[model samples]
Target: MSDILLSAAATAACLPYPALADELAASLTDSAVTVPPRLVQPLPGGASLFVMPANDATVAMTKLITFTPANAGTGRPTIQGDVVVFDIATGTRRLVLDGPTVTAHRTAAVSLLAAQRLAPNTRGPLLVLGAGVQGRAHVEAFVAGLGVREVWICSRSPASAEALAAHVRTLGAQARVVDNAAAALPDCPLVVTATPASGVVLDARPREDAFIAAVGAFTPSMVELGPAMCRDLMACGTVVVDTRDAEHEAGDLLQAGVDITALPSLAEIVRESRPRPAGPVLFKSCGWGGWDLAAARLAMLRVCAEA
Candidate 1:
């Protein structure tokens, strides 16, 4: 077996969104290996820290280090971090994957994957409710997965929204910047919320037919969806998660009074479902160790091939 290690930068350079998503879905459904649990720590300095560790036979080992500082000076409570990939077989450090970029792509891809299974008939005009890195990744992954025809980028910052719209336009997708979240919501069948907000950004009550992907909140102290969203998810379509253990760390679901018993595990969704979901569905991912290892392993293969 070829032993290859990749740094974060190198991994980012080699891993593209479309290919990564394909690899991720296959890895997620694989029955051979067990995904390791996430390690969470309470930072005494006022930051919440989380570490996701995993290894596939080819990838060797991978670790994703994430930090969410207390919302003191900043209005947003977002995650910031890095992912390190190592080759255990050779004792070689492979690469440091760009935490922000990788997180954005992987998270969005996860949403896209869930959307693919949950809402196959919904074609966009997709609405993205954030203009940050995560939002951009959603746009990329959505187009890659669903052939999104148009995208409406909405954000607290008009200029940032315009910038993202312009960037998306360059990718040949019809794009526009919108200031009102409500105005953007009705035009699209699919919505993705990638903001770092502590409360609901979009009203989930009115849009009963819209499929949503919420990937922003990670801790019990932060929330993005309101009670209505959780209620709808619990009652309507299947709410798929990467792992139940990670959901315990999410502030969005816990604070919204979501019952953990109602949500279905990802593996169950893949194996038990028939014809998939036809109506509104929601996927809340807190990230998982298996995805990190899969991405890292793919990046290492590229690095080894180049060598």
Candidate 2:
């Protein structure tokens, strides 16, 4: 057994996101790999701690994440944690990787994959909700993966949203802070909502051909898309989840009284069983454990390759 560690920056430095996207696109199957629903523990002040574990044949990965929503108000990120990867056969710990970073990258990769299948031709004016870890990561992901022309940023904190927009401009992508995100939706074809708001952050869906990748609201009680959008998706089979486990964890769909089994999984879409449904396709993720394991292993390989 061998052990190694990498900072989030270092792991990100060597991450070939396009390649990782390809890897993840093929990683999920009916039985070969799976991510179980995370075990959750509520914390004081409405914060939450999650212990997630996932495994395949060769290795297993576990991540510990704590969400302190209040931290974002104080100039710190809301999510903090790390990921551990080990040999499954021997059960020996092999690598420890930054947790939130892994989550960010994997979450974005999943979104990108879903978008590739759902709205392969969409371009320009991507609307991103909440300028936090997931929001920032999704901006980079969309810019890299889709060549989006402009990104509209919206957040409860104007300064944080503006700060992210400024950083996004530095990446050669056009970005702006939108005071009214709902009003900005029609202009954008792809939207990524990465917030923990219990109420709807994005009031309306893009009316045209589009994709919405929602990552927040893991618990059954926290929702992001509100009632009408979920209801509309539920009726049309337009909603897609990163995995079947999302049925148990995705708050947006669960709260909207969605029929979990009715929605198709990402693997099913990727494998060609289901065509991308018509209009306002949604990819809701409650955070898949398989994604954590896959990302950690990729980081481990990148670490070794750079040595």
Candidate of highest TM-score: 2
Q: List, residue by residue over 1-307, the lDDT tens digit for candidate 1.
A: 1233334455566667777777777776667545767777777776667777776654555455546555523755356666677777786676766665567667777777777777644588888887877888889888877888799888888877999999889878999888787766667778888887656787654355677787877667767778676776677765666567645865667876777656776656665654676556777777787777667766766777887
C-alpha displacement of 172 in model 1, angstroms?
0.6
> What TM-score should be assigned to candidate 1?
0.87
| Candidate 2 lDDT tens digits, 223-298 | 8888778887666537888888787888888878888888788888888746656767888987778787778767
The numbered model that scores best in lDDT is 2
Q: How close to the true structure is residue 134 of candidate 1, measured as C-alpha lDDT? A: 84
* All candidates: TM-score: 0.87, 0.91
Candidate 1, overall lDDT?
A: 0.71
Off by over 4 Å in 2: 1-3, 89-91
